[model samples]
Target: MAEQMSRGSQEPIRNRFPTLFEVLSRKTVAPLDLYSFYIYMRDQQRAVDYLDFYLDVSQHLILCRAYVRRLHRSVFEDTPEIEKNSKRSSYILHDAGEGPSGEKGSIADQRLSAFLRSDHGSRAQSPQNSHGSGRSSPAGRERPPRPSFMTLDSPGDSSSPGHASSSENVPRREDLRGSAEKILYTYLLPGSEREIIIPQSILHDVQEAIEGPDQRSDPELFDSAKDYVFQAMERDAFPGFLQSKGLGNLVPQSMMFRLIIGLISVFGAVWASFILILRDKPRTTRCWLILPYTVGIYFIFTHQYMLDPILALLGYSEYTLFDFNRMREPFVIKTLRMRSMSMLLFFLLVTVATCCIFIFVPGKDL
Candidate 1:
């Protein structure tokens, strides 16, 4: 049973990682993957408007789906029940020789009717109608008024009569449509404060689909827009993100090891030079020491070049010498590994040769 549960848990992760890897590997990314990249870019201080736009479109699509589902459920399932209840109550009032006006409605029904009527009246009086308002300014684009039915109190609080009554009031279809449109204008419209930066063609396509006479929400409305955003990120943003120094910071252990090796190599070279100079040896014997110094110095220099950031700040012509991104390339990594190994071997051989010359080949007195 535990094994089965573990497999179930792993299933989602296994599906997700492949998509994540594809995005990281410079392959196509989905809308959700784009959001992950957006967060990274935001932290790295890179431009992320494109990803932001994609996220907004995705959210708008979700809201539309929820609106459509609720609308259908109300129209097909709940409306008939409400109508029958009203008719039955009217008949009871008639049998008692009392008009509908004389019958006192339930407290919950009275409050709900009054709230809906007031809300509908306010919407009618407002000058900036949601349907006619096309790309209004941020100040002009107001959020739809929250229905009085929604309260901060928990739904499970059975003690509060207000909460109990409010919970029964379902928002009318028009209110839902207006709220969805308000969200759409606030984020997705071209001139709004939180405007997305999608292409005009995709923007127009979305607008037409949402504002059409049919009023039906189709899932495919945002598909083209999503594909366009993914392509844009893959082409432009993803490459730069992969090459960023922020990405290099992710592997501190490797960088720390390189720094230690570089410092030791430099110190060893300096110490070896001093030792050779202090010895009272013939010029020919001293000349043999150059081989070790050359190998040691070269290794130190390459290491310093790879790790130093000061060179870039100084506007050095060879700024690429210290580029973390360049150093991370597969070919460059392989070349550096081989070169470091070869240099170490060469240094050892030169040290051995120099020592042998000093011992076997007698140096003339200087």
Candidate 2:
């Protein structure tokens, strides 16, 4: 129910975004998940940034779980952006002026981390104001230290461009699950550089919450300005955003909402048609008048999807979700599209049923 009110509603702008006072009121017990954001430039962190290639969220959980499993190797040699010690993930793990031999972690954190560098400067260009001003490009800051030939440990033969073997130099195409998850989490930021991913489940969840006793007015604004520096920059070549959960059932995609809306509309139209039929002065002009003709036509042709164009124009048009189908799988679209063809037939049946119940009953209808 994320305030299902249209854009031109009566609420004020400040009310639209949740306030600190509001969050403490009706917070749920659901665990909060944190995802990192980043921006890359100047030919650096190729492995860390490579997740941009497969930036899809349709089957996110499956992808992330798979990537985590695949990313078993040690972290990359160059990536000192992440802290490597045992106690806990420290916020500032970069070259703390304690020299270049930074702490090293398990082999897993090291795998492709060689490509990452800390975002010591502002990543966002400018915030989008209420006045609709376009996004300003963020000024480039001084570049951080580039990775050297030495590996993560305090010794020779680390994963820098120079000392790496030719085999490791080639990008590890197979185990990119972590990178992909990181990319998706990056885009879920406030004023994200990436386009908004309208995940249906999360959207629906938000809606339900908004409609409940305590609405989550602005879930995106929960993150503070201090944490905002971690904005990850990316572009979606395909731009088909899946659910926030990252993966699940294929049938009820975001488009399914539109389809449900379509079906409800058709039902309303049919209901209105029956009301008109009841109001028709010539009681003999039955509601089922269209049925015998439907049977006759069905014999002439086995099945035809759409209502007649004339009828279609008069609010009987079958909604063809070509725009929606683009996101659904071929099998789903085919199955739904095939079922949709019978809508005309269903309408005829409903119409006939309406007439019989109204006109043929012996006593005055209830």
| Each prediction's RMSD to truth | 15.6, 19.9
Candidate 2 per-residue lDDT over residues 51-101, each given as its tens digit: 221122212222222222222222323336454443333222222111135
Residue pairs in clash, model 1: none
Task: Compute each candidate's TM-score over C-alphas.
Answer: 0.40, 0.24
N/CA/C clash count, model 1: 0
lDDT of 1 by residue, 1-366 (tens): 211223444322221122333553333322223333554456443445545545444433333333333333434455565575565533432322212455542332333323333334333323244443553434423334222112312324431222222323333334334544553465467787556567888777767755654332333455676677678776766655543321222223334455566567546645654555555555565565555455544444434433223322222212122222223122223333444456556556865664455434444333
Show where candidate 2 strays beyond 4 Å: 1-110, 115-282, 286-328, 341-346, 361-366
Best by lDDT: 1
Candidate 1 ranges with C-alpha deviation above 4 Å? 1-17, 20-36, 76-127, 131-198, 207-220, 238-366
Q: Candidate 2: what lDDT?
A: 0.29
Clashes of each: 0, 19
- Kindly provide the TM-score of model 2 when superposed on the true structure, using C-alpha atoms: 0.24
Local distance difference test, per candidate? Answer: 0.42, 0.29
